[model samples]
Target: MLTATKMFMIVFTLLSIIKSVTLSACDEQEILDISDGELLPNGDVVFDGVVYENRDYFINNVTGIKTACPKLVINKCCPFGTGYKTRQCVNITDSFDAPVWDRYKLIEGARAREMFRFRIGKINCTRPYARVLVSQIGQLDWSDNWHLKSDGKLFVELDSSIPPWTVQPPDKYCIDTFVYEDQDGKTHTRLDALACFLDETPPNHFEVRSTCMLLSCAFILITVAVYAWLPELRNMHGRVLMAYLLCLFVGFILMASMQIMLTIDNITPHICVVLTIVIYFALESAFFWLNVMSFDIWWTFSGKGGMTSKKMSKRFCAYSLYAFGVPTILTIILTSLEFSGLPPHPLLPMVRYQGCFLFGRSKLLYLYGPMFFLCLANIVFFIMTALRIARIKHETEMLKSKESAMHDQHRKDKQRLLLYLKLFTVMGINWILEVISALYPDADYIWCFTDVYNVLIGVTIFIIFVCKRKIFRLIKKRIKENFTNSKNNSEELKYKRTIPTRLCEDSQHQRGSVETIRTTIGMENGVTAEANTTIL
Candidate 1:
C-alpha cells in the first residue's frame, strides 16, 4: 500500500511541471517589442515586431484579442495594463514619453468588459500640417472619418475622398470623414472651405447657383423636346432654335452635376477634367449659335424675298460648322493646357490644385474672351437687323394706300425680325451680366442679378420661342387628335355595352350588317339634346 501511494504523488508532481512550462512558452510568443522603430510620413511605423514575433498573440487595429489571449492568459492578460501595453494615436514627431500623446490619446476602459472586443480609443494630433489617417486595427481604413479635436472641440469634417488633406501654413484643419460626438460639432475656426470646393467653389453660393442651373436644364430640355416632337416645325428657324437649346441643355446639365458632385466624398480628378472641358464646349457653342441666329435674321430681312429654301439649308449647315467648330478648337487648346499643366496664364486662386476650376480671369482670357467677342459682334448684327426692318417699314408706309402681297410679306418679315430681337435680348443680357460681374469681382449686386438671370435663361427662351401662337397651335392639334381617337374608342365601348351579352355572342354573325352596326354604334356614343335610343 505505501509503494502505490508514493507512485501516485510522483505522477501528479510531473503533470504540474508540464502545465507551467507550456503556459510560459505561450506568453513568450505573444508580446512584441517596439524599440528602435522608424516612423513614416503618413503615421505608419516600421518595427520588427520582435517582442511578440509570433503573430498568433498580437491582433491588428487593436480592435480585439487574438485566439490565444483568453485561453492562455489565466487572468485575462491581454492589454497587459499600466506597465504592460502602450497604445494611442501619436504624432510622428512625438516621443514615446510625450505626455500630450497620452493625455489626449484614448484608452478603452470598456475593453476589459468584452473578451472578444477592444474599445477603440480616439486621439488628437498636435503636429501642424501633418499627414493623418484613421487606421482600423493598424491597417489603413481611408473611409473612416478623422474626428479631429482642437483644444477638445469639434473641428470641420475633412474628406478622405480627396487627395491628402493638409492645411496651408497659415491655416489649421484636419481631413476627417465624420463628426465625433465627444468633440463639440463646430467647423474649425480656420477651415479653408476652398480646399474641399474643387467641383464647385464658394460653398456659400453653391445652393443658389445649383438651383438656377438645374432649373435651366429643365427648361432647355423642354425646348429641345418641342423642336423634336413636331416634324413640321423642323423648319430653318425651328432647327436653329433646337440647336441652341441643345447646347444650353448640355451646358446646364454639367453645371448642375458639378455642383452636387463637389459635395461627394470620393470624386476623381479625371472626371472633373472631363466635366470642365465639356461645359466649356457646350457654353461656347450656345453663344455662337446665338450669334448665328442674329446673322440669319439680318440676312432674311435684308433680302427682297431672295432667300430661297435651298440657300437657307446651305447657310444653316455652314453656320452650324462655324458655330460648333470654333468652340471645338478653343476647347481642345484649353483642355491641352489644363491637362498638361502648361498654361501660359496664372491659375485661378482655388484652382491651383483643385481639378476643373474655371472661374478666373485667366480662363476668361482664353474661353470667355471669344464669347465676349461673339457678344459684341452680335450686337452689331442686331443693329443692322433693326435698320433693315426700319427701311422695310418706311417702304410699307409709302405704299400705305395699297395692300399688295409684297407689303404683306414685308409685314411678316418685320414680325420675324422683332421675334429674333426679343430672343437675342433675353439670351444675351444674362451673358452680358456674367462678363460684367467677372470684370468687377467686388460687384455684389451685379453677381446677384447675374445669378438670377443665368438660371432663368431657359424660362426666357421658352416664353420667347415656345409660347408663340404657332407652337401652341401644334400642341393643341396633337391634343385634339388624341382626344378624338380616345373618344371613338369610348363610343365603341359604349355600343358594345348596350349590345347585351346575347348580341355580343352573335357579333361575328352580324358582319353582313357592318355599316348598320357602325351607324348604331355612333348614335349610341354621341350625346344630343335627348338621350338617343339605339336599336341593334
Candidate 2:
C-alpha cells in the first residue's frame, strides 16, 4: 500500500511540471515583444510573429513577462478616448476587401466583445431605418453615445421605434455580420446590409457643394483679375485685396476639386492629404491678409505722416511677410504633428489621421480659433479708426470740403473702410455658419442654408466691390483709352500707306520733335508736387 501511494505522488508531480512547461512555452513563443500590434477578428492581436488573445489580455499579461509592453495601436487614431479609431469617409466601391471579410468570420460568439467599440467610419444614411439595420451588437439601437460597464461589457438601450427582428437579443457585440459554428459543426450566419459602405453622401450633395464652391472660385479669380488689370487698383490697397482674393480662390478651387474627386472615386489617400494641407494654408493666409488690411486702415487714420511711394512699397513688403510667414509656420506645425508619431490628443491637428480635412474639435480650434481672434482684432481696428475720424471731423469743421486734395483722400479712405467692413461681415457670417453646422451636424436645414449662402458670398462680394459706380467709371475709362489708342494706330498706318517712304520718314522726325517740344512745355507748367500717400 505504501509503494503504490508513493508511485501515484511521483506521477502527479511529473504531470504538474509538464503542464507548467507547456503553458510557459506558448507564452514565450507568442506573447513576447508586441508593440504597435493590430487587433485581429478572433479577439487576438498579431504583430512581429507574436500574438495576444485581445487588447486587454495583451496589456494585462505582457507586464513583467516581456521586456516591452504589448500594445495595440493603429494610425489615424482620432476621436480619441471613444475607444475606437475613425477612418476617412469612403464611397461605395471602397468597402472592406474580401480578405477582411474572411477574417471577420473569426469574430463570432465571445470574440465579438473584443471589437466592442471598433469604429468603421461615419455614414450618410439615407434610409430611415439604416442605423437599426447596421448595428447587431447586443441588439442595441444605433447611437453615437456609448457606455462601458465595470465588467467590461458594452450596453446600449434599445429604441422601441426600431422593430426587433429577433425575439431574443444578442449576447455578444458584433456589427454588420455574425458567423459561428455549433457543436454539430454547422455554420450559422446572420448578416445585415449596412449602408456605410455605400455612397456616404447623396449623389446630388457633392454636385451642389462643388458647383457652389467652383462658382465662388470663379468670382474670386475675377476679383483678383480686376485688381491686376487696373493701374488705379494696383496701388497698395489693390495689392492687398488681390493677395487676399488669390488665397481665397486657391482654397475654394482645391476644396471643390477634392470633393469632386471623392464623388467620382478618383482620389487616393495621399492626394487627399496633400490637398488638405494646401487648402488649410491657403485659407489661413487669406485670413491673415484680411487682418493686414484692417491694420493698414487703422494705421492710415492714426495721424501718422503721409507715406511716400518708396515707404508704401516697403510697408507692403512687411505686410506680405506677416501674411505669408504665419501660415507657413502653421502648415509646418500641422505637418510635423501628423508625421511625429505622437499620441493622439484634442489639440493636435491630426489631418492625416482623422480625414482629408479638419473636423470636430480640431476644426474649431485650428481653423476657427485664429479667425475668431482676427475678426475681433478687425472690429477693434475699425472702432479705433472711426473714433479717430470723428476727432478729425471735429477739428476740421471750419474746413469741411474746403481742401480739395485732402478731402478727396479722406473720402477715398472712408470708401476703403466701408469696403473692408462689407468683406469682414460676409466672411464673419460664413465662419459663424461653419461653426453652427459643425456643432449640430444633424441639423440638415442649417446645412442647406449654409450651402446657399456660400454661393451668395461671391455674388455679394462682386456687388459690393466690382459693381460700384466708381468701378464702372474706371472700366469705361480703360475701354475709351484702348479704343483711342487703336484708332491712332490705324490713322498712322493710313498716313504711312498714302505717303512716299522718304516723305513719311521726314514727317515722323518733325512730329517727334514737335511732341518733345509740347511735352517740355507741359512739364514746365505742371511741375507741382502732389502728395502720393498710399492707403493700404
Candidate 3:
C-alpha cells in the first residue's frame, strides 16, 4: 500500500541499526576501563575521565609550534654568584625558545620535556668533561648529555643509575635550526640545544687559545722568577711590572680552566663565585699599576717637580693600596647588587647564565671603563715621554763635545725613556686593543691578532724585563756565586785542617805551645790533660 520511497527508507533504517550494534560490541572488555584512567606511552599518569590512549594532551601538546609555550610559573629562586647548568637554551625575546633559523628540527621530542624543567645555576665541576643528568618523576633514571648524531639528529643518551621511573614528564621537545650554505654569502648559525657536557677535546681554535695562554703563563713565571731572584730589579718600575704579571697569571689560569672544563650544564658553582673575585682582582691590579707606571715615567721626563727614583720609591705602599683598594670596593658593590634579588641594576644578563664567569654586566663600566681611560692616559704619557726624550737627545747632541759627563747622563736617560715606550706598547697599548676586540665581538678578523697579542704579552714582558742586559747580569752573578760558593768553602776547610795539624805538632814540643795553641782554638775546643796543661 506504501509508495516506493517509503519502502526504501524502512529498509535503510534497519540496516543502520544492525551496523551500529556490531561496532559497539567490538571491544566489550575495555569499553571504559576505570581501574587506571590512561597509560601514556611517555609514562605520564592521567586520572581524568578520558579513557584509552590519547596523543592530544601529552605528545602533540608540546610538539606543536612553539607559539603555544606553557604559562611560565616561577616555582624556585635562582641565586647569584654561582655557576649553573644551561637548562634554559634560549633563542629570542627573553625566554627559552628554539632558534627559528635553519629549516632544521630536533629529533627526539621526549627528552625535550626534561630539558625545559632543568634548574639553572646548580652544578659543581668536580671533573673535566662531566655532564649533569636529570631524572624522571617516579624513578632515578637519568638523561645524559645531548650531542649531534651523524645524521644531524640530536641524541640525548639515557643512563640509568637506578631503576627507571614509571612516570616521567611529558617527553619530546625540539628546536628548529636555520643553517646556511657556505658557498653562498648569506651566513646563518643554527644554535640548537647547547651540549650539556664540556667537550673532552675542544675545537681546534680553542686549543690554540689555550696554548697561547699556557705559553704566556710560562713566560710570566720566568718574569716572576727573574724579579724574585734579582733584588736589584725590585725598583718602582720592577715592582709594578711584577704586580701586573701576577694579576695576568691568575686571570689567565682561571680563563684556561673555564675553557677546558665548564659548559652550560656542568657549572663550577659556589667556588667559582669567589674565584671570579680573584680574577677581577688580577685584571684590575694589572691595569691600575700600569697606569701608575706610565704616570711616573711621564713625570720624570717633564722634569718639573718630578720626584727622583729614590723619592718615587717611597710611594710604593700608596700605589699598592690604590691599585688593590679601588677594585675591592667595586667588587663589594657588585656582590651586593648580585644577591639583592631586585631588578638587575647592572649585573648584566650573563649573571643569569653560567655562574661566575660573566657574573655581572657592571664589569663593562667598573672594570673596562677605567681600563680604557687608563690606556688613553698611558698613550698620552707615552707621547709626552717620547717628545721629552727627543728634546734631551737634541740638547745632549749640542753639548756632546763640551760636556762629556752631561752627554753620558743624557744618553742613559734616553735609554730608560726608550724602555718606557716598550713597556707602554706591551702592557698598555696591547691591552687597550684587546678590550676593543671584546667590545666588538663580531669582528673576528681583528680578534685573531689581538687574542694572540694579549696571550703573548707575558712573553713580551719577559723579553723586556728578564731578557735585558741588566737581568742577564744579575742571573750571571747568581750562577757564578753558586759555582764559586763550594770552592770558597773548600778553601776555608783546607786552611782550617792544615793550621790545626801544624798547631798540634808544635803543641807536642812544649806545654807553653800547647797552652798557646789551645787559647787560639778557643776555650770551647781546649781539653785539660792529667799533666795540668791544656791540650789543643
Give the Cα lDDT of each candidate. Answer: 0.57, 0.65, 0.54
In order of appearance, the predictions have TM-scores of 0.53, 0.61, 0.54
Using lDDT as the measure, what is the rank order of every candidate, best first? 2, 1, 3
Q: What does each candidate score in C-alpha RMSD?
A: 25.0, 19.7, 19.3
Clashing pairs in 1: 31-51, 31-52, 32-51, 32-52, 33-51, 61-137, 61-138, 158-176
lDDT of 1 by residue, 430-502 (tens): 7678768768865677867876887678888777768989889998887888799999999999988878976
- Of the two candidates 2 and 3, the one with more favorable lDDT, higher being better, is 2
TM-score sort, best first: 2, 3, 1
Local error of candidate 1 at 268, Å? 2.2
Q: Model 2, 34-77: lDDT tens per residue?
A: 44666576646555533444433323232423222323221211
RMSD of 1: 25.0
Best of the candidates, TM-score: 2
For model 3, the stretches where C-alpha displacement exceeds 4 angstroms are 1-208, 263-267, 304-313, 345-356, 359-363, 391-406, 428-433, 440-451, 512-536
> Which candidate would rank higher by TM-score, 2 or 3?
2
Candidate 3, number of clashes = 16
